[model samples]
Target: MSVCKERAWKTLEELSFIRVAGTQEELKAAQYLKNECEKAGINAEIEEFEIDMPVISKATFEVLEPYKKEYHVIGIGKSGTTDENGIETELVYIENAVDVHLNHVKGKICLLHGRLNPELSEKLIKAGAVGTISIAGSFYDEKSIADELRPRNTFGKGGQLPGLVMHISDAEELVRSHPAKVRMVLLQDAEKKGISHNVVATIEGSDLKDEILTLSAHYDSVPYSKGAWDNATGSITVLEMMHYFAKHQPRRTVKAVWCGSEEIGLVGSRKYCETHKDEMDKTIFNINFDMTGVTLGHEICCVSASNDVMHAIEYLAKLENNALECKLDTYSSDSTSFAGAGVPACTFARLAPMGGAQIHNHYDTMEHLDPDSFMITLNFALHFAKQLVNTTTNLIPRKFDEVITKKLEERKKWFSEEKDEKKKESEENKDEKTKEEEKK
Candidate 1:
C-alpha cells in the first residue's frame, strides 16, 4: 500500500526496453503499465492516438571534389525526399546558419552546427539551400556509440528540406576536408502514420470527486535506449504513487497517466490534453515526473504555475529537509502540455550532473540508478502530493504570472502560425492541381 522502492525498481526492470514512439514496443509498455494499475485494483484504460511515423528507406551522404568518401547518416523524418540520383551541390559550412551565413548558401548543401528549429528551417528554405546536414553526438563519445545518430524530424509546416544528421566527429572531418561538392540522398515515405497510446487510471475521491489531481510520466523511450534513467524511473515513480493513493483515498480525485511518444515533442501529452479538454476545468493540478533515481543527481522542480504555488513547493521542500531546487518556469516535458491547457503544473526531476549519466542513447541503462536514490524523490513527492490532496482548501492558484503568461502566449502564437502556414500550403497545392486539370 505504501510507496515501495524495491517494487518500483522491479517494475522498471520489467519495462526496460527501447519503446520508441508509435512502435509495437511502446504499445507493449503502455499495456504493461495498464495491467500493473489494474493489478493494484485501480481502474485503468489505454487511449490510442495517431502520430507521425515516417519511414526512411535509404539515406546516404557522400563527399566529392576534394575527397571521395561516404559517411554513415540517418535521414530526418518528414524532411522531404531527394531525386533518384540525389542532390549534388557545393557543400558550405554555415556554422550557425545566421543571416550572414545564409547570403552565400543558394543552391548549396549547408552544414548546421546546432539544432534546426522551425524558424531556422524556414530561413534555410527561403535562402535556397538544397539540402542540410546537422551535427549530433560529441566528439568524445565512446567509439562503440559514436556513430549512432539519433533520428529527428523537421517541425512546423512547409519549409521541408531533405536533411541528414552526422556524428560530430564525422562532421568535424567533413568540414575540415573543405569538400567542394557533396551528394545527399534521402528516400522515405513522409506521409506515414502510426498509433501511440496513453494509459489512464483513476481513483475517485471520497468527497470532491469532480476535482482532479493528475500525476503523469512518459513511458516511451528514444531509439537505441532502454530509458532506465531518462524516464522508466519516472514511470515507476508515478506507479508507486498510484499504489499509495489506491490505499488511502484522498479528498480529491487522483488521475495517473502514463504518456507515450513524449520524446517526439510531447505528442502524447498534447493529445491527452486535447482529448480531455472538457475535464480541464475541473483539473486542479498536474504533477509530472520526467527523470529520477540517478546515482549522482539533485532534485529539481519546474513549476509552470503561479509564483505562490512555486513558493509553497519551495517552502515545503525546506520544511521536509528535502534538497530540492524549485524554480518557476516551463519545462520541456508533458507538464508543459498541461500548463498550456491552463492547468497548474510542475515537473519533478532528479537531473544528473554533467559527465554523470547520459540519456537518449545506449548508455542510459540501470547502471547509474539505484532503488535508494529513487525513493528519495518519491518520498518527497508523496509528502507534497498528500498535503495538497487532503488539504481543506485548494492552495494552487489557477493563474500564471506575467512572465509565464507571456511564454505561454508565445508558444500559442508559434503553433498558430504553423497551422496557418500548413493551411496556406495545402491551398496552394490544391490550386495547382485544379489548374492542371483545367488545362487537360
Candidate 2:
C-alpha cells in the first residue's frame, strides 16, 4: 500500500466526526492532529485563540395570515433578537433588496433571496425592516432535507438585525401562494467567548533553515456535515505530507498546520498570522488544501503567488504528467489569510461534479469520497513541495504585483476597520465607567 494513501485514510478516520468551530469536537480533532505528528516522531503544539460563539435560544418562522404554519429555520448568529412573540407584519418577497423593494419594505417582514453581507444588513436596518428570512437549498432538493444555516462573521461586530433561513421549497410556497404576513423569531445570546486551536508541526531543514514553507488545511466542518469530502480529506492529506517530510527532512523548514474555525471566516489562520507576524516575512510560500477526494472531481490550483511561481508550477505539473486547472488568483480558504498578509500562497481543491457530492450539509459523508482521487492530489502536492523546498537555487522570489496587492489590501481594509471600531467602543466604555465612578 502507498504510504500517503494509508496514512491519509488513517487520519481521516480519526477525524471523521462533526468538528464544528469553537466546539469541543474541534479541539478534539486538533489534539488528534497533534497526536498524529507525535506518532511520526515530530513534536507538535496547539495554539489557542478566542472566537465568538453565538448561542441560539430560539429560531423559527411562521406564516400567520395566509396560513398558520411554522418552517424549520436557524437564527443568524450575532444578529440581534426579535420581540418575545416575534415580529408579525406584512411579508414582502423582495427578490433582491433593490431600491424599489427597499422603499416598501419598511415595518414588514422581508424574505430575501440569499444571505446578507455587512453592506446588505446595514441597508436592511436603515430601511426600517423589522426582521428577515433568507432562502437556502434548492427547489430541486427534497423539502425534507433542510440545509443548516449558521451565521458567519460577515456583519463584523455591528450592523445586524434578526434574520433566519428557510429551505427553498418552503420559500417557493411562500412566494407562489403570496403569504400576506409572517412572523420571524430569532433569539440569540449576543455573542460569547469560545476557544479554538491550531495544530502546528514543524520539520527542521538541513540547509536553508531560515526560509520556510507552510502547508495547511482546516479540520473544522460546518453545521450538519461530517465533512469527509469538504475537508476531512484535506486535513488527512496535510497530515500525510507531515509524515513524508518527517521521514525526509527538506533543505528549508516546512510547517504543517491543521486549522480550526475556517468555516467561520478563516478564524484560526487569521489568528496564526496575527500572532506569528514576525515569521511572515521569512515565509516564502504557503500551500493550502481545502476539499478533495471525490470520485468525480477535478483539480483546481488557485494561485496567489507571483507570475514566475505560477509558470514554474505549470511547468512542473507538465513535467510530472499531472493535469490541473491553474489560475493566478486567491481562494476563500486558510490560504487567503496568508496571502492577505503578503505571504505567497495557493489553494488546492478537487471540486466534485455537480450533484455528485454535497457539502456543508448532512450528506457530506465518507461514502462519497474516493481514495484513488485523494492519492492523485496527494502525490501532486508531494512532488511540488519537493521541488520548491529542496531546490539548490532559488527558483522563485516572494513578490506580488499590483493586481494581487490590491486584492490583499481590500481584504485587509475590513480587518483594520473592525479593529478601529473595537478600539473606539472600548474607549467609550471606559468613559462611561468613569462617569459611573463620579456618580458613586
Candidate 3:
C-alpha cells in the first residue's frame, strides 16, 4: 500500500480541532474531511443525527457562600437549565450510585467515581439529583470521555437522566470540600433531538463488487478530550489508506468509514451497522483502527473476528513487518460494538495506554505528539487494509470465538460483583464500630 505522508498529515491537521459534543466544530471537521475524501474521488457522506440534548460545552463550578474555587466539569455535562444563583445541595460521595441506593440522593448533589457503571449514572437522575459527576478512572479516560462516554439511550422506552463528568483530581477536591456549601450551575441551553452522522468512502472493486472489506475508524468523539491518538489518527490512517486503494483498486469492495458518535456509547458504529444490515451481512471482513500511536510497552494485539480475520491481519502483519506488536482488546474501541452485535469484527490501536489520555488532555496538541511509532502503526494498518482489499480468496467465516469475548465480559461482571460484596462488608464493619462507640 502506498503511504502518503502529505495527505495523511493534511487530514490530521484538518481534524486536529475541538469538535465537542454536537457542536458546529464537529460538523465543520467532518465536512472538511468529507471534502478531502471527495477530492480523492471517493464518495463520502455525513451520517447526521441529533443529540438527545446537545451537550453544553463550557460549564463552570464555583464554590459560593464561603470560598470560590473553580472546578472544570470533566466532560460534556448534562443539558439542562438551572437557577442562575446555582443549585445548593449537600455534596456526598455515593460510592457506586448504580450499584447502591439512588433515593437517598434526593435534594442533594451526588459525586460518583469507580467507573461509569450504567446502573450508577441513571440512578442519580432517578434519585432526583440536580446534577451528576463521574470521576476519571484507569479506564480509557481519554477516548472514553471524548467519544465513548454517553448516557445510555432510552429512546422509545423509558425515562432519562441528567449528568456530566469530571476528572479524578477535580472530583477529589470537590469531595474533600466536606461541609463545603456551593452553588453548582450547568448551562444546557442548546440541544438537538437525535442527530448523528457517519462518514464513509467507497472504492469500486476491479473484479469483485459483491465482496467487501471495511477499514473503519469512528470519526466522532466525546467532550473534555481531543480524540487525536484515540481516533483522529485512526481517521487519518483511513484517509491515507484511501489514497493507496483508490490508486490501485482491490478485488473486494473496499470501504473506509469514519463513523460518528462512537464515543457516546458506540452510537455511530451501532447505527451504521443497523442501517447497512444488508451490506454488513455481505461484509467479509471489518478491520477497525483506534489508538494506533505505537507506544513503547503496548503490543498491537488483534481482537480478531471469530472467522479468522485475525489470521488475515496476522498474516499481513508478518508479511509487512514482524516488528509489529500484537495485542488483545477485550473491552476497548468501536470493534466491540460490532462484535457485540455478532458481527465479525476486531479492534487495533496503540499498545501503550495512559489510561487513554495522550490525545485526551490539552497536551494532545500535535506539537507534543510522538509520530515515530505512530508511523509504524500507520504503515502496518495500511498494509493490512491493502492485503484484505487485494485478496480474492474468501475468508473462512468461523463463528467469532465467543470464548474470549465471553470471558472478558464475565471478568467485568465478576469484578463488579466482588466489589459490591467487599463494599457491603465494609459497611457492616462501620456499623459495628458505631455500636461499640455508643456502648463505650
**Residue-wise lDDT of candidate 2 within 64-164, one digit each (tens)?**
87679888888777767886798888888787878998999889877888876666777888999887777788767764456565455444645357877
Q: Which has the better lDDT: candidate 2, or candidate 3?
A: 2
List runs of model 3 lying over 4 Å from the truth: 55-87, 96-107, 122-131, 137-164, 180-191, 194-196, 221-227, 294-299, 307-331, 353-357, 368-372, 396-398, 403-440
Each model's Cα RMSD: 2.1, 1.9, 11.6
Using all chains and alpha carbons, the TM-scores for the candidates as numbered come to 0.95, 0.95, 0.73
Count: clashes, candidate 2: 0
Instruction: Report lDDT (Cα) of residue 367, candidate 3.
Output: 54
Candidate 2, superposed: residue stretches over 4 Å from native? 150-154, 157-159
Please give the CA lDDT of all the candidate structures. Answer: 0.90, 0.83, 0.64
Model 1 spans with C-alpha error above 4 angstroms: 421-440
lDDT, candidate 3, at 27: 77
Q: Which digits, one per residue and each the tens of the lDDT, describe model 3 over residues 1-440?
A: 36666666666766877665456777777887789888878888777765555445445566664567766553343334465566776666787555455757787767765654445545566677766556654333454443333332222211233345656766766766674665566555433455667787888888887887788887665555566666787888778888888888788888877777776656677667777888876777677888765445354756655535555566667876555555434545667656655556667666555443355555455553456666777777766666666766775463667676675565445335535755887999999999999999
TM-score sort, best first: 1, 2, 3
Candidate 1 lDDT tens digits, 1-440: 57776789899899889999999999999999999999999999999999888899989999888779999899998887998799998998887767889999999988888877777778999999988888889878987787667888767663368988888899899878988888999999987899999999999998988899999999999999999987999999999999999999999999998999999878899899999999899999999999999989999999999999999999999998998999999998999899999999999999999889999999989999988889989999989899888888888889988777788887776567757976988999999999999999
Clash count, predicted structure 3: 29
Candidates 1 and 2, the one with greater lDDT: 1
